[model samples]
Target: MSPQRFELLIGLYGDDRMAAILSEQELIASWLKVEAALATAQAEAGVIAADTAAVIAGAAVPATIEAGRLWRETRNVGYPILPLVRQLDEALPHEHRGRAHYGATTQDIMDTGLAVQFDAVGGRLTELTDAFGDAIAALATAHAHVVIAGRTHALQAVPTTFGAKMAGYLGELARDRARLVRAREEMTTVSLFGAGGTSAAYGEHAVKVRTRVAELLSLRASDIPWHVSRDRLAEFGAACALLAATCARFAREVVDLSRTEIAEVSEAAGHLRGASSTMPQKANPIESEAVIGMAVTAGALSSALYRIMEAGHERAAGEWQAEWQVLPQLAALAAGALGTARAVAEGLQVFPEAMRRNLGADSGLVMAEAYMIGLAPRLGRENAHDLVYAAARRCRATGESLQAVLSDMVPGEAAGAVAELRPEDYVGHPDVAIEAALARWRDRG
Candidate 1:
């Protein structure tokens, strides 16, 4: 949140969703918009711009001379767009001062300005979400055939395809992608319900301007006032929250697999990977950690947005303006998170042998599920359950192999049960379920 970082996040929202919200060009554009709106409304009402709209539009250029001069004038308002308004006034000469921003509240121009900013920001979100989806799907495919120990409650449970685990993550991100789309669409609606959220000021022409602005920005315009209907904004923030949470979840998983105790997987080692200061043996997943940390800030940004949505009725300029900062920050955050996530996923080092070794480290004990299922048919459900359960209990007590205990279960002693069982027969449908999940993904497209 340093000043420079705060500013960079706004631009970098091109990569993630939370590091930034609005851009400088965005603020200027919105000012130019208020200028344009006034000019458009004036022309329709015979006030101005039947011919001067082009002049007004050209004045909005981010690199314009007037914009530079306005920058100098508004250096300290904490709201620079107002200086642009004065500068535009100077540019318009006299007969048009009345034509400028006529019959408009600051909210009128500011709201439309935000609508325009959100339009550009929303487009970037689509791109980032697409990248995240690609990363998850790619990870799922790459590891789909690699067997891994599926742990439950921090203990080994059964065998599973690494791809199956990744696919579960991918599924979560898929829902996230949909949530982002909905959030963007909801936030994309222009706030140009006109002055005071009513059409009284511009007479009959207010209707046309509202509709035209929505069309110009490729956004939907509501039939009624929503100056207080902030749910749409909350939707945008929530979408970012989901994306951040996804990143954190993915990062934590990477960290876990890279742990010394696990060592089943590691972040793809590269020349740029983190190095140790003392051990010289550590190649820490720093990028993964960074991604995890970013989630914290991104979540905060989403909360800021949620809080802003509780603004007083009609409009709240301060709260809305804060979004000018918050929204871009989140956008940049999600973008960067996705970028890092892609890098981490694509480079993951999976050890199938390690997975197999870990899968049954507890003295061939991970075969309990298969043993139960296999015995159910031979031992008449209840009897089979009691026998196997007792055997498993004895194995745990003595720290002996489950196979050793099963070997003593004799032919008639356990209702014709055999002791020559292998752990492979117990993994159930892990491979097939993984294959089917991937197949379903392919078909989903």
Candidate 2:
């Protein structure tokens, strides 16, 4: 069977989810696009006659090609480019066959083909990021005023706005989008340096070929020969995995929130969810768990990509093939993770009532910070801490309110500071961070 057919059958593992990036139509379309680019580059540099270039362009249509036949030739030649070059050769009507591919190396066409795919994949990633950003913003808007006890060491340490917590995630996502954007450009550059990592075939024509190829493909010209660096390829792969890690973290948070005992938040579930024999009433977060599971594998693939960077010299077949396996898979998984993360964020339900109900453990003593601040002017900083420390223990152990505890320990100036304080006065400003995230996304297009 054809490589294209294989991908269609197994590329997405039972979920077509976001496998368009690896589809026969998409991958083969990239090859056709690069062939047209090669034709354009050759014609612009006077290497191929204008009329011949036109014939080559007319025949590069993706839909007209036989994918199975191309795959057969590729398998026979033991290289992916053979099918592409042979197909281009047959379509040239004999007159332009000799001029096709011109002075370009195999890596040149392969890298260009890869860039075309990156262009399409980059667009999808941007859309996924945007959808997730909208979801994050909605969460921030909805929870802007929900006060919750922020914890460290699994114990409440202070009051924080739930919106503020989401703001931090929104900030991280903004940075992730920026990194993905840069990785897209890095992956999309034209590397037309000829065979053996040099432009020897083109000779004095190398500069013209490089410049024209970049212009034809709307990509930057690679300065040094990147035919074998492999680092750029790995960086692109690593970025995808890193984005997956972010998705994993988001999924983990959802899982934490959905825990029955915690109940501070929950993933919205439908009637058919968790319909297994054992747990009919359960609302298991299968999507979140699936996304998190993909993240673990994506991280491993990322490490493999970096290992390929150690494949030094002109080229290493083993390392290159490893990349072909890992990078596309990483991209596919990242796309799925981002898509799932956006959905979770969009439908995530916050229960301020639950947060308030959960805060009974504080016994109104989570307001220790306010009391500390209130007494800072009275007993001096050190003494006020001593008094509040003594009083806080009473409140925690005996379930006493701060007001009652403070009555016994009130110092001269603290009486004045304590009168103005309230338990609800300590929530921090989370809306500022949300606005910052929204402003960052405005320039995404």
Candidate 3:
């Protein structure tokens, strides 16, 4: 194992469960599992002796294999499967030696092993994402009516509920959850076709042996050999990228809202968690920042996975090799981003008073839309817009409040309507949207 400066960063960004799923030991164990399942399938199909298959299956574990020897052999052989099969056969009695690998090819063993690893990773990601979604839903429900200034172009435009913002995140997370579940289902299939994907080695019992192996491994049997069709892996990567983007979106909002001037929301209190080295007063949004960093890396890595889809012929050379490096990193980064997002959601701090104070900071200017809407029925849409625009200019020029300026410019009924408008009153039906998001989450659960 080469020492890397970014190893600590990767650990912080990634989940321990995901790390275990993609570990070298686990990867080798998955390969052994595939080999064992293949032996069992061949035995059942009468292609190999039952006692020989049992002996092979019994020896299919990492503990029986010498890691140092396997590594050296793999380096010499240009792939791990040849060495792995050699090690497995060496572990069994001489009678069972030749039956260890049977009809399976290198791609069949490696691809099926990768599918098992991905299945585990997908399960963990689904659980984490569900927890994150629940946290977001709870936040939305708690603050469903808490109004804050809505910003556009980094300036206040109107009033919106904090719950509405969280609800939007929850909704997107819901869709992401569904997408991940589908990707997991699609990708968790056995790749058992030999050599050229025609299963010529297995002959008449190809489909039956493939199906039996899939059952033994708890995976779906592929409709055809996907030795060259990489869409399944690509689709899974795309789902992960979309999930990371959603997490980044939420993290960015937290970063923006936690700004010194905004102060509407922040990470939960921590004495030194976000402290800067030189700046004693600094309490940064470190979790959100880390999440964004992981998300950016995942996005870049996902592009590589997409590029690998351009494989040529029955098998690829460089494109196939590229996935061996890219997929694990992409999975790790995505899982890391999800872990950070979950932490942020569970510990988020909301300051309702600060949100209200900021809403009024512009002296009712943010409520201009409300005033315009109220006046549109009386003055016509264009005329009402002009009237509000002129009042805004006068208020700025005379250093008066927008409400006072509107009171002077409009007649009794229109002025009454403008005077009656509160920032909270203008936050149209965000609770309904929140309810919809919550309902969707519950239904999915």
Best by TM-score: 3
lDDT per residue as tens, model 2, 201-248: 866767887877688777878768887787777777877888888888
TM-scores for every candidate against the unseen true structure: 0.86, 0.88, 0.97
What ordering of candidates by TM-score runs from best to worst? Answer: 3, 2, 1
Q: What local lDDT score does residue 53 receive in model 2, on the 0 to 100 scale? A: 83
Candidate 1 global Cα RMSD = 3.6
Report, for every candidate in turn, its global Cα lDDT versus the true structure: 0.68, 0.76, 0.88
lDDT of 2 at 348: 83
Candidate 3 segments exceeding 4 Å error: 1-6, 411-413
* Candidate 1 residue runs with Cα over 4 Å from true position: 1-21, 41-47, 65-81, 379-397, 409-424, 427-445
Query: Candidate 1: worst 10 consecutive residues by lDDT?
Result: 10-19
Highest-lDDT candidate: 3
